[model samples]
Target: MAPYASDDSTTGGEVDEQRSGRRKAARYVVPVTVMGVAAATIGLVPALADSGDPDLPKITAQQLIEKIATSDVQQLSGTVKISTDLGLPDLGGLESSLMSGAAGRGEGGSSADPTAKLTELASGTHTLRVAADGPDKQKLSLLENAAEYSLVHNGKDVWGYDSKSNEVFHGTASESPKHEKGKEQQPPATPKDFAEEALKAADDTTSVTVDGTAQVAGRDAYKLLIKPKQSGTTVGAITVAVDSETGMPLKFTLTPASGGAAVVDAGFTQVSFAKPAASTFDFTPPKGAKVTEEKDAGKGAEKGFGKGFHKGFDKGEARKHAPKSEEGLGKGLGGMKTIGEGWNSIATFDTGGEGVPSGKGGGDLGGFVDSLGDKVTGKFGSGTVFSTRLVNALITDDGKVYVGMVTKDALVKAADAGK
Candidate 1:
């Protein structure tokens, strides 16, 4: 967990046992939003296990960085899948409530099932078609039920199509069409997507290294691992599989210090570096489909790309600024206050005000989040602890949400001190 670190080392690295004995910890945020914390159908391509190739050159951490820093893969196509295991209960409503929590932040309207984009991300297997022709054209399709949930980008025009509902959402984002410096140009995958996002701000809190080689998506690749030096975080390490020849990330995963399974495991099960076909990036929502034109809220908007609240964990601290609060800590979305800094930092929010999401129990953290994680109480004053690989939030009966990448005890300490 990047922001919320739970020191499972205290348990001698046995989170599975605690999970069996206690309330299971559900994943927070859209399954695919932060990292590849969601599942996908059979991978698009079969992964060719690494062939014994002793000649694979050994590259140093610095060499790997240089390769990644200079890599520019302009055209490619692949199958990207995200899988997660937070040991959470099956509360189908967790996604909806998290969306409602966003509405509580005063961002905008949540008319759409706000959770629609993440529907495939919540649990079961979801397969996506990813292709990129250039900076101007990109396409991603999540295939389901004879229909496809797709996002197509051509030039500045973007289209979101839900084949199941025969609905196509259109919008435009205005910006100077310019390539970013040293930005990896591969088709988007959450593991690589969020890794790039987290890497930009990782100077003080992280250590980057090059692990040995591994086969991914039938390609020869080098492994790069990123570990947070902050002892307060639950994140043990983050590993990215980088294409050896092209320096593109072929896979990515976020593992917790708890010794449980991977929390966010996402990568291209099958991939091709070949240039995508022109039609692959084109989309004409089937005739008779509902065509809704929307203002370009942004690329990562509610119904646009990733999960709803993912904006908070996004780069540039957009989630933090979106809910600017007028009251003190834990007052509202805007009232989110931080305790400490770096990886150990704890962000507290008041979910009691109007708009903040609360469950049927009204003001009860567990009720509001509705089965997103294990139900734990005690020094924290009775509530639920929402655990994701990167961050964990303790929603107390007191109407406050304490979140960080630290152990449960750390959250309790923060709660008591704030009180």
Candidate 2:
């Protein structure tokens, strides 16, 4: 009887201990099971990565481009910052002024800021073209027009058309200078022309790396880094964020090659890529505006020197003796027989003025004057003269031909000749 009781008590104690252990485990098991399910669901449905191949799928440049080319278009509007080597004067101020002026003019429903221009181009409606004085100036004017390329979806097969010059240029993905020149060399077939040209001329490209994920234009995007392959080739490496859903490039940054130093950056906002109307590529020359094919006249003329010479001549005795006439200033200057046919505006001169002595030596006058001619040629192809210089040639911007210079004395002589 004593043994039985002892055994029974021990069994009871063991049963109670087992029950307590099971209760403790039950307390944790429910929460643990829930957590396990949550983790498994996350693993199955992967969250977007920041910028890597695993997080972001690999894509070829051509594939990315095709997506943009074929996407449906709706209205797009946003702000963007473009970077280029062109020397624009106070771009921020210029943008402000343009905005105000456009508001006053009230031309279209368009906004005046360059950021607005990007949206306009992306909209794929009217041709968003820029009319620059010349190519070198055009390069710098990217910001002035808002760092955006006009979109053309019309059936006319124009991608990078220059309506101002009535021309088209095309390009390929191959990295070669032979194809990167301009509309004169490669008539643009589509927006891809601009990208291809830019990539071809890129000094060095880094190993492409895809970062994680982010939102751009309210869409998921993958960031990519393209560093310059060579050292000191560009300011730095450029990183671009492409939309994973639409495959359109969303944001791009250019870091300075010298580590953290950077000169400029550009971005696209409120972006969309879509097929445009059949008329988007259609353009007609303004009734009186002349449309001429662009010619490769080599690098544009240098600035500063030519304008400086003009300023110097203005201060010198030459100003006093310069033949003057009621006709335009160009006519008066053209009256000088020594002045040649291609002379445009004198860019610079060192006249003995104010503090300076008389007959101050002209510094590199030939180069200075020659640059003026080059500028004229660049604008209108080898022969267009500035209106000021046209007075001598008896030529007018309207294509009128004249002879003899319009000198102040010539006016008197003309009066006498008439008499």
Candidate 3:
């Protein structure tokens, strides 16, 4: 039977079997290749999309103000760690030391000075913690003494407490009835209003940008970068983590703009919307603690008129030691531009040197004028120029002679000084 014709039949069968095996292998390989490619493409798409949309929401001034007007209570609490730059005005070259003290305090350590305790508490989230940085880091040291401040708003009252000094400042609600004596009733401040005021008082000259997204307390957030319009301020750029869901602020970062120093990061680890304790708004002085009433140091008072106006200087000739450069004096006057119509031109004088004693430090010009009350009544000028003059007999830290000029002139000098 010719060996059952094995050559033709078996060879054809073998060829068919090999073709079937190849197809099976190809079926498995094709899907995996497609899946891998699809995953890679999907991953790359989000990055490309996010890159194209860099402009963050530009919150208008009016929007911010309105938010403040409507808010009732706002509270942010959390474990906070801060790294500050002493080079900035706020830190006052003591940022590192202050941070170290704060860390120690968080670990249940004690500091040598009361201010250190305040710093630790102020930077913390507890009732004792303080909110230090705003739009600019320059105001860090300025608030060092505020370690004991409490901002509380009840449904009908707003109260500010300075625990360090054992004083309570209260602002009555707008709807409250005035005393028969005709005292004007003050209205309580809402949380939204507080936030708005803080934002407004922040360094507006600079612009802020959102860098990207981040995670805070396991929630999505956006990182915002704030830059100063001018130099010499405590803050250069602040990276803030804003909650994605609520648009509320979570964390803050303070860093130098030129990239020379370490960055300071502070954040709220916990937050609650519940109304703060009623006692939070009450200010009762501690036993044996002296209570001092706070006066609204008028604009001139800020120039050095209050009781501690010359705390850093001596009594006889404090002006002899006042800051001389136009920039130094102008810093205090920068806010004059924002003052609404109520006053005329503002000026500063370097009362140091010559016949003036070095003990005569800068006095609060606002307070001095305010004491005169109606006698000094003048509507704030829209285009007021604050002038300052340095007594040539005195010299500044940099060996520069005493300098003085008005706000407008100081700005001009500051701009030209660099030239």
- Model 2 segments more than 4 A misplaced: 1-81, 85-205, 229-234, 259-264, 293-419
**Deviation from truth (RMSD, Å), model 3:** 17.2
| Model 3 lDDT on a 0 to 1 scale | 0.34
Worst 10 residues of 1 by lDDT: 315-324
TM-scores of the candidates in the order shown: 0.70, 0.32, 0.37
Q: Pick the candidate with the highest lDDT.
A: 1
What is candidate 2's TM-score against the reference?
0.32
Give the TM-score comparing model 3 with the true structure, all chains together.
Answer: 0.37
**Local distance difference test values of all predictions, in order:** 0.61, 0.33, 0.34
For candidate 1, write residues 15-66 as lDDT tens digits.
7567734533443434445354222222322332335432468898778877
Clashes of each: 24, 44, 53
Output the better candidate (1/3) by TM-score: 1
Of candidates 3 and 2, the better by TM-score = 3
Give one digit per residue, the lDDT tens place, for model 2 in 254-333.
Answer: 45433453332345544444432334335443454332221221111101211212222222112211222112223223
Write the residue-wise lDDT of candidate 3 on 1-419 in tens digits.
24534333222477776876676687899899999989988998767645433344555434433333343223333333344332222333254343333222232121222222233322222222322111111001123344544543343433444555554443333333322111111111111112222244244454655577676655566665555455333234556666655665556664543456533445544444343344434444467644322224211211111111122111111122222212323442232111111111112233232221122221453333223212211122111121212111212212122222112333333323322
Supply the TM-score for candidate 1: 0.70
